[model samples]
Target: MTSFLPTDEEREFIEVAKGFALEKIRPIAREVEDNRIVNDKMVKELEELGFLSREMPEEWEGLELPLISQAQILQALSYGDLAVIQGLPGAGDAASFIRLQKDHPILSLHKEELIQSNKTIALLDLLEVANSQITIEKTENGWMIDGVSQPIRLASFADYVIVAAKDNEGVPVVLWVDIYQDQVKVDSGDYRLGLLASGTGKIIFDQVQISKQLALAEAEDAVKLMADTRNRIRVLQAAKQVGLMEAALDYATEYTAGRKAFGQEIAKFQGVSFRIADMAMETRIAAHLVWEAALAVDGGKNTAAGSSIRALYRAHRSLRFVTDSAVQLLGGHGYVQEYPVEKWMRDAQAQVTLYGRERELLIERGEQILSGAIGVTV
Candidate 1:
């Protein structure tokens, strides 16, 4: 019964986002990446457009758009530049947690600041419990967070951080930390790959003591919340990847159609045309998977988590293929800095690394299916 067609309001929002992305975001993408920051003016514009608060609850002066609507809008915006969309100042990935637990006591305390200020929140998700350097220990009255986190988007400028990790005893917990009060240090790295405009950096927590009041959830509640939050994040991120894929696909198609090689347009050649067809197929597949995942999450289905994992894994795979195909199709011009295909290819790779490993996601989905936690249809 799920409909693929977007509602009138959703279509309007997508059109507006698409226009702003091409007109405003695409033009300054290089400048933003070069400066390693999204300027305040652009951030204000995004805020005015309600892009920054799309996932937040209406009670907190946010749009509280459904996952499907948000996914389409985000895909449209990110079509211009994924890094710029990521770098925009706002709640960042923590928006998913806020949307899931809108009325939590800890979140309620910060509701005013979140609604009134442009302060951003970075999420350090250590729930994977593999290849993580961050260590969490339960204390007498609270918990102590130590070690440095991997490069997380928005870490460089985040005013707050949400940690979703298991303690030394392996009890899952979610905690919020005030970056300034806790003296969390942002370790900026020499990132040359992609997402340069994103506030990508490591956060150092040297024996940071988080009181019990800051613990958003613990034990079973924390596990459930983290699962739902991660699913939502995966779906949204997959939507963004789909956007980048479409951008690369379209750019490559146009380049091939115009650039002459032998005696005519290169697109006339089978090699070039075949690759374009493949890129288009990959993009369409990724888009459909992301949309399905978004709808599953919005519907609060039991299979939502598995669907999200499948969507993201496919998105990661297809994004890399499509972007690389774009570069390959453009030949020499694709490798040069003057063209945007190279940047898109780099961004696609960086995005895949940051979100989740493709193999891991696939394995997780497989396990979910075998365990009967999610049906094969998902």
Candidate 2:
């Protein structure tokens, strides 16, 4: 089957991204896994390549590329290193939120900062917010936030943190707090099985005070904003997963063709060859599912449903099948840390789970479908 190919511009960007990954990111993947930190050199190179700002509006110091273009870029970068490339430099998601809420007063204060800052910004992920235990209180000076947020992606590298908390009335409140404040504490050295270089950490906010102007969204608006942003992130994540699956399939195919078993190449066996074929077929399906969702988001169609289907497809089935099968084909070599297929498996699992627990997402998607709430977004 002829899968959709990238446009000329997108192909150019992919090549540039691939070169950057091989030259800059791939060399340090092991070092990052060992050290559990993303170095400044990689961050600088990503910035120089204009990756973090690829989707931001021109007025906000972004390239304002189409969402599909951003997805392609992410896939290319993830082909190099998913962890460091996923959300580095800053909270591009926060920028997207700000873009969605341009009329909000909080955006006025942070517009330039969101665009021009060299420091990364961390947005509290909705999936993991329950662990954060955040609450907001109205004070004479402004709003006070208190909570402990665990395993926030890139919070250690972030100069600013964007949080979505609830007020006494249970209304959602979005707050942008400076990480250097006296009340903020970050335990940045935590380790993980995958995405070790994400700089994930535990953050404690003790009576952090910010002006009322920092409250970015509330009530139903905040809920909707979160849903929208989740869908947006899912699209990019699906694209990255496609890259991971494809890379794994490619590596395994090459390995099986060359490696010998019973005095013959393993690829000669029907069982092994069939599995490779299945991996290719599944990877193609995953890629197309991602594109379907991305095109929906780009066209402002039924994004919620489209994104949900994309997430369900990749998280529940496709990636797991591809990565696990790749491992099976590689046998002992796949399990070794020296070969990257094992790392890819771990990374793929971690990413798919980031949106939510698979069981819960499965139920939610089913409910959405049964309710007929899902439209023909694609």
Candidate 3:
């Protein structure tokens, strides 16, 4: 019995975001990607528009919007260009951790730098329990972290990093590391696939010693904090993917409608028309799931975590399908740099990889249902 309609305030915010995205962000996407960084002017504009501080706390000079509102705003912005949106500065994924634990002492130590200096932070969440090259070992004072991490968004420019992982003994811990102070190495490797402007790179920790003072949470506290933060992150990421899907669907539909083939518009063909219909349907479904997940998280429902996993999985699948369809519909034009569909497709693939693996998310959701952790809903 929940309404999916936006409130008047939300509607106004979304419209502004949509307009700014299309007018400002879309035009410079190619330039940003080529330069591997968002220009200073665009970054300043985003900050002025409040898009950079949506998840941050008001005490920290942020809008601190709810996940539901943040999701919609992000969706509108991402519709212009997913790569540009992802490249934006400010807390990045670590904002979820800060939002969930605004009062943590460890976080307070860095609040001044983060808010005043506009320092960026990256989240290296190794709690996935998957195969990771990074290792965390317990030390007398705190822990010793070593090895290289998978490519993380915002890594290249991160002033600080929030590490969520387990020790060699499988004890959960969340640590806040000052990258420059700790002398951590950020490897900005050759990245050409997509999201080239996102500052994506690997963080190399060479037996770096972390003091106990930097531990944000440990043991059971860390586990709960990570789980809640992950739910928010998943829903937000899924919302962005839905925006990309919508962009692909709309672009393809418009192109097909105007382009002539065999003395008629290509939209006249059933094959083209049916594919566009499927793209539209898929985009709608992804948006609905993302909205549902955002609501569940905001409501503090037990199903929030499970719903987030499902939402992201579906968004990833639909994003890939929709982007590819856009490319196919445009025929040769789609593959060329002259059109945006090719870049969208590459960005979509990279987005999914950076967020989560499709099969893994599906399996996680299935496990949650079977264990009665979350109920099966229609």
Candidate 4:
């Protein structure tokens, strides 16, 4: 079946985002992979190019494009490099969440910082330090935060920190604190198996004073917000992986066809050709679901049920196919860092864990949707 191709106008914008990633981000993919710094330079450039401004309102300095546009941008950017895409100078796609603030201080600070950032990035808010273990306390000056946050994406490079803390009422909420002046950020230097450019550091908010606008109306809402953000990230990231996996397949196909093996070119061998076929087919399906979810998001269906299904589609099913099959086609080279497949494989691992682990998210999302259950949103 013929897929829905993008409009010339849409493609034009995509090309702009693509060009930035290809020219600016691709060159640094290796270095970013080798280094711990989530260098914000490329991200800043992309932000300026309007890469992160997907679906944002023009009035708020965002493109207010569409959710599909947002997904496409991330997918293309990931093809060049996800680390650079995420370690963007400020924040992307975070404008809406920031504007949702009724009295959420953290969001207020974030919005202000984003303006200063020139819409360079969409930073991860520091809600639930260490995924809901650490706590933030309201203080006389403003609000005092205590505890360490793990995997602060581009923490060292982030212009602002979106913090999650509890007030005197024990209400879980978000706190937006700027790292440059208000708080101190520490680099963990702990490297991961993949997705390297992200600072992925430990951030400590030691008695940091947060103003009134930084706090969530209800602290308990932090968990919901986290779930929502993770879902969005997962679905969009899946779209990117689809692009990367296809590129890997192309490399395998071209290489195997041209290289001579036992009797003839390896592409003549069913072993080589079949693997490529599977990867290609699986990639198409994944792309569909990724787009479906993006459209769902565009349709305003950001429920856990929807998000979890999308997460399951991408993480457990689509991601698994892309990784395993890509490795199969590459033989030894797939496992070696010399090829980008190895990096792609490692990066794919993050999809499983991010948002919620597949099984956990599956059970939660499945049971609810199957049984027609719904969680109350604040």
Candidate 5:
């Protein structure tokens, strides 16, 4: 069974993050909601507090905390404000890549501080893919990147993008290029049902320069990188869902326990109490699935629960069901912005779509499982 419970020090770290979330993030969530842009000051504060790079190692100017601990803290932070920083695992994922890919040039070039912040930020920004055709052709200088990248997270905020574009040889190559010229635009079209912190911006790059050091080595690594990163973030996302469901449960419990309806506390009603019971049950399932995914990945037990299959799949599905129940239990209050459950529900919806489409992911997994050429552990 998967478990993400923290040890003594880890618990302390989570408590600190919780305090920051409650004191700072929660208060300004609504303000960001109204303004439709994350406050730069908050981003600076989060960076200054080392909240953005908590899981990176001391070698990279981070705490190198346990993955489980980082998940817990991120869960709390999302509860405070889902709109500001919904993507939480990039710090940890960057640290893992740097630690694993010893000879990688990307890690070799940056200073320690920039290694923690800039590199991680770059990886985080790559979440935007709007069917952009990437062309990476060898040039006299190095490589020229010509393609239209689709709506990306933090598109307006990022100076460069870590892109997986096709090469002249028809190889799906990866490159990092500046986002200058070529009509960079954001589609602030309609407020998403949730996850307001993300700026859905469509990126266009016309004849941008790419250095060899920044491009990923192989055509296949792009797919692997995306799958690897999703598994990492899935655990953290599940943890945040825990916080969201917990908050919603607390809200429902309080309202039902005191608010009288039909001459009785709503909590006294069997229907209300039963829904709470279901929430509790599903929350446990989600927690177990998330922890299973994290430990399985870290321990190299990928066949059992990693590779974005077993545990991540369970966690994502559980997140959807649990948040839906929470929203329903709260009735109309759950739908309005006045209550935080509505925000949590909206954020959960975005989580479903963030890394990749759930439909495509399932199809890919099915095709892999059905292909009998390679040995796979069930």
Candidate 6:
């Protein structure tokens, strides 16, 4: 991330995470993807090791580490396998948004359980107008939520799903629904291009009755919460992008350096070396921006249209370029699954499309800048 190096504790944590990745995730990466399931034992180990509690409150048995530390942990874990990292037991950014709202009704009662159990909470972003398929209605006893969520990440495995919707007056509201409730139905599993092991799926609420205890009242600063959640998810995704680019670059570099062409190493060729140099430059820039975004978030700065968003968009493009170049450098070998380059490209594409597409971020940031709402440097 910036020029700054990791502290002793951070370095130790990264090493432990790397060891786990090598020992647990790397061996099972192919098996997990083929079976479309993550290793339960490995996930349990991460939970017990406190890797899942990075951003939680300490009072509830959370680690509450700095954002940069959390970013680094996610990045290191992602280098092992993006799908496995996604499927890990932890309160993702969605749950983090609810947890930050001190007055959340449901979270108030179940906060401790959430932290102690390391339960994953899926978020359905009904705020996306293009995907505003869900709606909520207030009932006499609780709330009746009816609609379908399209391919929520980890939906099949989530202990809870925090739904974002609008009320009668079009005010945004969030609902905390129990995944096992009778009214909740998982329509189908996703067979996407990548991240199949992350348990992506569609969920349908057929007149689902949410108990009052499970409903989170609209927070006073719901807008801010939405912005912060978006920024944080982008930051986390950016971290994953950094790992992907770095791994791909390293793989390609090593391959070119050792492979002989025209009676000489491929890396010795000016064209080959220059392409690798470009990939390295982009990867470095992406990594630095990710850390800068994390730092900005940790510093309590707004990053909706700022560094966090910029970093996310830049990383998306950079990762895509790096992975593509890596595959090209590997030539025929990269197109096959025998090597990791193909898989790295797949993972990079997934990250590029997830959360928000690179184009969407660019357009939003462009509009904001042109409107004078945010400076160009932001």
Judging by TM-score, tell me the better candidate of 1 and 2: 1
lDDT of 4: 0.61
lDDT per residue, candidate 4, 1-378, as tens digits?
634467888888778767766687777778877775545565556656776666455655767666576667666777676555555544533444543442354444445555664533324454433355356666665677666665545565555666555555666666566676646656566557666665556676666777776555454467676646555655666666666666566667777788788879988888777777777787777777777666665566635346536644554566666676777677887888777777777766754544345666556566666666554321
Write model 5 residue lDDT over 248-360, tens digit each, in one string: 66666776787788898887889988987877777677666666666665665545323435445655666676677767777787788777777777777776675455665
Error of 4 at 171 (Å): 2.9
- Candidate-wise lDDT, in order: 0.90, 0.73, 0.91, 0.61, 0.61, 0.77
- What TM-score fits each model? 0.97, 0.88, 0.98, 0.80, 0.82, 0.91
RMSD each, Å: 1.2, 2.9, 1.1, 4.3, 3.8, 2.5
After best superposition, candidate 2 residue 4: deviation in angstroms? 4.9
lDDT of 1 at 119: 77
When sorted by TM-score, best at the front, the candidate numbers are 3, 1, 6, 2, 5, 4
For model 1, residues 124-220, the per-residue Cα lDDT tens digits are 9898758788898999999999998989999988999999999999999999999996457999888889999888999999999999999999999
The candidate maximizing lDDT is 3
Tens-digit per-residue lDDT, 1-378, candidate 2: 533478998889888987887688877888877867667777777877888777666766768776677777777787777776754767645666655666666566767766666657777854325444766787876688887775667777788887876776666767778899899998865456677777677788898888877767767777777767667767776777777777788889999999998999999999999999999988888777777677777677765555746554664377788889988899988899888888878877766655455666656666666777666333
Residue 94 of model 6 has an lDDT of 67
User: Pairing residues by index, what is the TM-score of model 2?
Assistant: 0.88
Task: Show how many residue pairs clash in every candidate, following the order shown.
Answer: 0, 0, 0, 20, 3, 0
- Those runs of model 6 whose alpha carbons end farther than 4 Å from true positions after fitting are 1-3, 138-143, 211-213, 303-305, 370-376
| CA displacement after TM-score superposition, residue 198 of candidate 4 (Å) | 1.6
Give the poorly placed runs of model 1, Cα more than 4 Å off: none
